[model samples]
Target chain A: MTKHKIRKLPLFTLIFFLLLFMAGVISGEPSRVLEQSRQICLSCIGIG
Target chain B: MELARKWVQIVIGFLTNGYWAFPFTRTIYQGPLKVVCSPGLNCYSCPASTTYCPIGAIQQLIAGIRFNLGLGQYYLGWYVLGCIGVVGGFLGRMVCGWACPFGFVQEIIHKIPGPKFKIPRILRYVKYIILSVMVILLPLLAVNEFDMGDPWFCKYVCPAGTLEAGLPMLVIQPDLRAAIGHLFFNKLAILIFFVVWSIMASRPFCRVACPLGAFYALFSRVRLVRLRLNREKCTDCGACHQVCPMGVKFNESPNDAECITCMACMERACKYGAISLEVGGLPLHSSPLRKTTKS
Candidate 1:
């Protein structure tokens, strides 16, 4: 991928995960929500 | 401009992963040290973690079941090996540059005004020694009643634990405060020392202390994401060296283990687009067939 594409990939992924994370938080399953949140945290860390 | 950059860094750092906050607290209510990546050399025992730290996990594994090598072994092996092979392979020390929450903490602290003292050249090896002794040798050699060794770094050092786990818990739980003893005091002192050091140095822990940083440094030369230099187009202006916080002379070796892939020099000094990230000596931007030769 081009540099612009590579950079945009992370941005898009971040937005997608953020939306999923918010949905998980609102879904009312605390354990699953927490797991999703942890995944988002890992994504933010960018190592996973 | 410098102050603006510092403020931007501080704000971004704080918003991204400040441990001393309520959102972090809410996240930790689910589990401690459960975050996939241990930002700094913080121990897993730090209450702020959402996942287990690899170092802490390895130590705990070694301490728990003397060479039985069952579940603990599998878990530790997977995490460490996966981190090295996958994360280290892909990003190299970019994790240190951008992602690590603890690194962000140190960056913020380093912004404070002070005469930063460089650790003596001889003392640079101290972290490797710490890793060999505290991380590897102790757990492998020593045995207690439960066939476990101590988490020496976590117990004795690791400021990340002090700031992220210890202080918060101590504030919240009065009994923990009463139980505080010499061990807590010692860790606190180490934390203070590093905190002070950070104000002067770019990343003292990553430079001289972090075993994980050491691990990543090993792969930096051949990692999938690495700095490339086009020698032909390059005037040896030395701007890259000047911009590097880690004191790397990028022209000598863009793949220097000390280079954290922070892109500061790449952004600032490469007037000719001479420096770029590459895999297998090919710039990531170029077509596979072109295989443009470096200057």
Candidate 2:
């Protein structure tokens, strides 16, 4: 594709999604939260 | 051209674990591995990464609150920033161009067949925004009275952590699967984004997103290393621009903030030898020329 012809996707879309993801984390209902139960902090040698 | 090719080869070899210098037995014992610099910036987290990454060390420092800088006699924070600045002042983003392991991975991923895309020009500024928010703003805000701030980049975004540190540890310990949570997915998504975007664009993250790159870019103009243009030497042929993978226009200026000083343009297009690595006011050139016309 020609450089000039490349459609400029809206920046807002990217921001909106990022903000939404952050909000989910703050709200404590992360849509795709990974279970942190089993992971150990290598430094601490304790489960995170 | 030959020198440039050799330099590129050396860079690739260093980055790709191409080891052949040692004898057979030592080579096997030492392995074809790059040594991980401890308490240094090399990400110890990457699986294919034989070397420890510096960012990871910084994050670990913050996480552990290891302020005994003198005891270890290793000041990682200062050392990392100093290394970056020294290298950047001399070579600009040559580290990103050649030595960065993550850059290597991104280049490989970008080679995949797909509908590649470039972030809109306006959106290119988002990397700075990310640097502000993720690296500076968040870390500053997260700091407690104890002066400990979360390593926001590692916590929120760094794909290197996920690929190098997270996935490997998870793979080793199957029991950790149950603990997987939203953070993992969040980082995974970021990794996927860069991986997919790289296919169409070259080092999108370094060009636009990397805060570290942004810092080095600021010094590109006056840093000991520079690209000089001879206005009188000739035509405004757009050869340099054509060769720059980052889409920098050379005729307009040589030391643009975006210019990585990869020397691809200088090595390939500058028929006049106008551009040369300069330290202080001296040009590292044997031949001197009289003043020429201005561009």
Candidate 3:
């Protein structure tokens, strides 16, 4: 890779890292998901 | 690189759905870790899933909005959507090729001895329809008298939920046996159909049915992590196209919606080093830098 192209790596890496951090901070805990999943969701199971 | 990708797919699958010890437990993992979304098509209802399925979570939020639309009791699943958007915006469908368990299952099935088939190009749009209708619109608009909406995608579709969660639950919970009805049979039928089809075609679900894949494909043109082709270096030899399991015509469109970024096309397929896995134009995986000497 040329030096000009090589310089672009850090920008992409930074964006990727920031996206991960943002996703972690934005999402809520699993309790809600667990509650939904634990039940035999009528819709998901095709009973609805 | 193919073997390495398969290993990554398997490892990520196991890690994302890692409650293997309690494989019979229909109850999802309620730990703090479950708050995070793994970038794949893993079902949250899977007995072994530690992280929540973003797609399922989004559907639930949409369904719940019917009763609480104006009552200030509704949340729009901003977090879940954000998780999906961030990942999709960066990696596109690379997750499908290297991380999704369902995709891995399809890949393995295609290896079975069978006459392969090619899906028509027009059929690729079906997944986008599934994403918009079954996943989004149906959940929001199909409320009943109780103001409850069905997760239409998961209910009538989603073989992942069926194979990972429904089948296991039926086996372990004796009481659930009585509840086995036509609906269960229908879901089983869908799963069987996909499984058999995968044996004869590559990633039929990903290409034609996966809402999550459709969502990610939207970002293919602008994703930070993607396959880049140096047009000047390309000879139109079609070697890269030959190895592409998704049948992406990289010569015409390197960042097409159908490109999965599996790197099969990048790993020595281009004799001129035209194709490479790049992070914003910087080559991450490609042929080694050519040796140059000062004149």
Candidate 4:
């Protein structure tokens, strides 16, 4: 309704997603996901 | 919510595990797509799965190290946690209600002819315990002689793994039969119990057992997408609660951890239009309470 509330929405969303993206980048999550994703998890199937 | 759940299941089905192909080839489709993560508790070992299970990855990360900092090569699985955090923080437990294939299965089962009843409120705490004990603490604490901790949740629990991966894997590779033992039977029994329980209960696993759902529940309050209630518009009617599969009393606590964000209370049950869906404080869907004329 108000300009303040309207401005807050996109700013908040942008900041939130930016923070999550930064966290992922800082933690090397993409590579880890890439590596882990490739192999079929043997233990998940009760093999271990 | 039901239609959305079905649509999500279909889309995810196509994404993670494509339509059936020739049996002469590998039963499980393995490709570059495996690098992605499915929002729900789909098993990675499932021949159909194109993405990794975050829960399985988290347990593996916890168990990969011996906790001896200098001696062991360690990976904390920051990526898995980050992916989970982003998804959970954005959508909360909506993933459980809509995107989870296993949850879809449970929903279908609950539709069968059976006497239905609500589970005890105390049982809702069980998922948090499972997340802490089976998923996190056990893997971090228990280690073998080689110092590799076991994925207790994956091995001992996780009916998703049993149904999607174990059963399918067994069918694909019959030699895995010899590997089947007490642990397998134990997991199978748990799956059977849950399957039957799901028939009688609306969403027993989502309410009581899923660690992934428990993890997402933590973000329900702060997630960007949220259910907003206008007290002024509410008549204190219990229609929303009656429609809620998770049995959440939204009037009491709109952000209750058990809420799956299914929007049933918002779109379907609330005749008063007290409830609305919002993203980042911006109202996306609003149903304003109608004014009653005085005779």
Interface RMSD for each candidate model? 12.4, 17.7, 4.6, 3.6
Tell me what TM-score chain B of candidate 2 gets against the true chain B.
Answer: 0.72
Q: Which stretches of candidate 4 lie over 4 Å from their true place?
A: A1-32, B67-74, B288-295
The sequence of per-residue lDDT tens digits that candidate 1 reaches over residues B55-74 is 65555444544644443332
Please give, as one word, the docking class of candidate 3.
acceptable
Fill in the DockQ of model 2.
0.02
Candidate 4 per-residue lDDT over residues B1-295, each given as its tens digit: 5586678877876676662661455556667776677899988778878788889888877887565343543356666776777788778898888788888889889999989989888999999999999999998888877777878899988998999888887887777788788888889999999999998989898899999999999887678778888887777777787988888988888879988778888877777878888887778886544555212
TM-score of chain A of 2: 0.42
TM-score ranking from best candidate downward: 4, 3, 1, 2
Number of the predicted model whose lDDT against the real structure is largest: 4
Candidate 3 yields a Cα-based lDDT of 0.77
**Residue B106 lDDT in candidate 2:** 70
Score each candidate by Cα lDDT.
0.58, 0.53, 0.77, 0.78
TM-score of each: 0.71, 0.65, 0.88, 0.89
lDDT of 3 by residue, B152-206 (tens): 8888899988998788766666567777778878998999999999998899999
What DockQ does each listed candidate score?
0.04, 0.02, 0.28, 0.37
Deviation from native of the Cα of residue B286 in model 2, angstroms: 11
In terms of TM-score, how similar is model 1 to the real structure? 0.71
Better of 3 and 4 by DockQ: 4
